[model samples]
Target: MIRSGVLQITLREESATTRIPARPDCLLGAGRQSNAIDRGDVDRTLRRWGASFRTSLVFAARRSLGHIGSQHIGYDDTERSLGMSRTYRVELGDVARARDALSAVRDLAAVAQARIESLATTHDPARSHPSTDTRVDAAMNAHDLIRATPALAREQGDERIVVAVVDTGVALGHPELRRKLLAGYDTVDLGLGKVGGMELVGDSRGADFTPRDDVGHGSHVAGVVAAQGFRLSPGMAGRSLCLPVRVLAAARPSGSRRTIGVGALSDIDCGIKVACDLGAKVINMSFGTSEAHIDAGAPPPHREVVDYAVARGVVLVAAMGNSGQAEKLFPAAIDPVIAVAAVDERFEVSSFSTRGKHVTLAAPGERILSLDRHGYRLSTGTSHAAPFVAGVAALLCARARRRGVELGTREVRDILVRSAQARPADGHRDDIGHGVLDADAALRTLDADLSASPHGRTHTHG
Candidate 1:
């Protein structure tokens, strides 16, 4: 778990002034020589910037250092893939101190960039509608609206494809999800204390192996993507494996008994990277932050890692946000990552679904029935809708693999947009990029394109 109230500093490429001696205590190993900056240099520099006694810094990927190249169950290749050695997380006592630290690091010759880490909550603002009905018929509306049944009938998805659900941890013991889940990781670092308005529900220590969902958001999202479809309705990619990366944790705000899901941007970034390293073909992000919440022109949160995952050939999908305004929300707004808006059974955009030029497509999301920590539950917002797209992406990947055809992120996205059903008469609209998702259409289109090419060329539309 990456701690909150910290500033992440990425050092510049190796230079005379930037290359300080590394300490034994520092986690800079053979491959991490690029991060060999002296701890004393950082401490002295911070003191010069008026950093309080409470300010401290540590390697951003300290927990992952020992796992490098290990055969262990929780091995993470983030440090190996993302040049993580050049990055460090500076912990601060307060927001004012964090501000000072971020400013001070810029003056350090070794520091190339620095920003205070922030948190993003789950996109689903509506309360969960818990129900006793676990019958398969109860959860058919959303899937039926998306034509998931017929799509699955054509391709039930391949077990080789893994969809990483980066959200509040999943319910490990849920009957619908247990067997379908691969071992997961928890990234919520409690650190010395909590920073945001919320508090961790159970464990007080930093993140560990277990990713049990105290808040049920991740479970619901996972169910939408790959639930076993035994007692509840089948998921979009029922046969695909689900890898839960617990970035968001259960949070209870002051004077509120109700719990919500919240996670720091750093943790989310690590979770995404780890998921990619662990062989996830598709990553589902059911949360986001608005442009107004971030600096006027600062890069979107998780931009670096998002690019890393895309480069690794992983397809990224995110919610269009529940604001229902035309403003942009990050990650989803970021290019190449599929942005999904919520549509009702009538195939019309939901009032709460955010609209923006970045929106890539729409799917059934209103009162969508999915899994909960306990049993079946109904939830709304783009959070649920994004998984529908993610699941479809998995289907496309699995189908491509079965046909011995390679599908990159761009190809998958292109297939989705071209095969989307019911485009607005005028053309691409902000509410729905092309139109509502048609999973079966996407697979059929992919097959037609593969068959037409002598060398199995992937289809693309400019």
Candidate 2:
């Protein structure tokens, strides 16, 4: 449930008793996500006990949740970021009952920050950052941004580096993404089954059973990361084995295609774990929402989600966001995840790219053309920018693995930031981080690092 939100209280324990170990103290909310409560058990144990407290309200709440299809809760055994706790979602009629339940739930500890009302709005740490005009685009062009010709000349592709795109599901038929796919999962089915309270419209093939991309966003982003680019920039194509982990639902109807929809935190958490388990060396996150900075002391919702991926040696990359404002958003604002901002053809920071110190690098994002369902099409937003960086990271990872050089997140991020062509603006660096993304330049940096290290491999860090 949104109320007790800290990466879902996942407790790992198998007790002999029929009762579960970790559970919420109260039940006054609409949804809860826990691995511990199965539908059969919840209907038998929780609903039965809940009815006794407030027969009418409990019955009504269950019925309402059922109508919205909340019964299709999600489960992921691979996610261990928060304490191992089974996910559960249920509605409770009374706060008093919540208190009483908390008192008796000896195995679980309730934290004040988990309340839903208190966490409704979120904040971006760098939104208020003062604007600064800069010449970073020139810096990237001087170093060859997006032109992967040189990198490919050295090595055709890195089969070992798995790059995962955890966004809306991807359209596998897109010619640009044919070889880029590894089997992916659909997390939208794990959600409340509604977008902004409206019943979902896309997924005619039933994405719940097989992941499919009704929205083209995921496929477009995947193009930037690893599209063969047969019809687009073929020489600049990325060849990392792409993993599409669909988290958002395809809700908006746009003729033959559906548009991206809002995603719940549970979907993202599940996607991150699946990506890591599937051997994703690089993961791209292209979605985010603004949060109120007033709650600075409160932990942001997705902090632990980002941390979990980083802890597992996954090189996480996130979009700086398309808000066109300075304040930074989640995942991108998180320290370990490399935040990428967008730049245009002229190498100027995109007007829509989010600006902030948290951004690690800049990439071509303004109306840049990439793969689409029918052919190549023009698209914009930090969504495209982040994948460019992800593609470069995967390319470098591929080359490193071939040379017997194992690299970690810190080593890869350092290479991109340090090798970037400096974009000095008015005597200081602007919000676009170090500069524009240069695929060839980053690979050269990786090669140099390997040569300098012992036995032709970069130093590893846990």
Winner by lDDT:
1
Q: Give the per-residue lDDT of model 2 (tens digit) for 180-208.
A: 68887665542234433334556522235
Off by over 4 Å in 1: 1-4, 15-42, 50-83, 93-95, 127-140, 192-194, 454-462
- For model 2, the run of ten residues with the poorest summed lDDT: 54-63
**313-340: candidate 1 lDDT, tens digit per residue:** 8989999999889988877988888999
Scored by lDDT, model 1 comes in at 0.72
Candidate 2, residue 126: the lDDT equals: 29
Model 2 lDDT at residue 415: 83
- Against the hidden reference, what TM-scores do the models get? 0.86, 0.72
Candidate 2 lDDT score relative to the true structure? 0.57
- Give the lowest summed-lDDT range of ten residues in model 1: 21-30
